[model samples]
Target: MKKLFIFTAILCFSHANNEMEALYLQNGCNGCHGMYGEGMGASPRLQGVREEVLLRRLKDLQKGKTRSAFGTIMVSFAKALDQNQTIEMAKYLSNLETKVDDERYEIEYTPAGDGGS
Candidate 1:
């Protein structure tokens, strides 16, 4: 039973990893979210973010509950992702170790309604 449980756990992990990779490629998320989820251009870095926060943000984007500085890019992008896929993506990205230079992307986002003044 113990061995079976261990094997099952390992298999599940591998499956999740594969799913995340496929999601990345299929959605072209890497083009903006980064190859390692470190993010690029106007996109925010997704690495190291808590899974809870990631899911909440993903749900918010999917529901159009939030917007980005780049118009509706995130809202549309997130719409294609399902809950499990989003969790898998978050797990894969969060497990990666980012370099100091790779930390160029800022996580602090200023909502559009917030006046700079």
Candidate 2:
């Protein structure tokens, strides 16, 4: 029974990772999000983002409820992404070991000329 449980756990993890990889490749997300989700363009790094929160954000973007620095492009992009893709990307990014430059993902941003302090 223990062996069966372990095997199932491993399989689940493997499947999730595969899904993440597929999403990464299918959307060419790495072009802006970095090969390992570091961050690029106006797109913020995804590392360390909570899965539930990220999922909600994606949903919001898809529905045009949340504004993004990437502008309307991200709205279309998010709308095109299925829920599973969002979950997979969030899971993969949250589990990754962030690099030295990963601060980009961590920094808080404010609206233009908001002088966020």
TM-score of candidate 1 against the unseen true structure: 0.72
lDDT of 1: 0.70
Q: Which clashing pairs does model 1 show?
A: none
Writing each residue's lDDT as its tens digit, candidate 2 over 31-111 gives: 677766778878777767777777877888888875565556678777777777777777777776544554332232322
State the number of backbone clashes in model 2. Answer: 0
Relative to the unseen true structure, what is the C-alpha lDDT of residue 51 in candidate 1, on a scale of 0 to 100? 73
- Positional deviation of 14 in candidate 2, in angstroms? 1.2
Tens digits of per-residue lDDT, candidate 1, 1-117, equal: 999999999999988876675666556776787766787888888877887788778888887886566837788888887777777777776765545442222212222245453
Question: After superposing candidate 1, which stretches have Cα over 4 Å from the reference?
Answer: 97-117
Worst 10 residues of 2 by lDDT: 103-112
The global C-alpha lDDT for each of the candidates, from Candidate 1 onward, is 0.70, 0.69
TM-score of each: 0.72, 0.71
lDDT measured at residue 99 in model 2 versus the true structure, 0 to 100: 49
User: How does model 2 fare in lDDT?
Assistant: 0.69
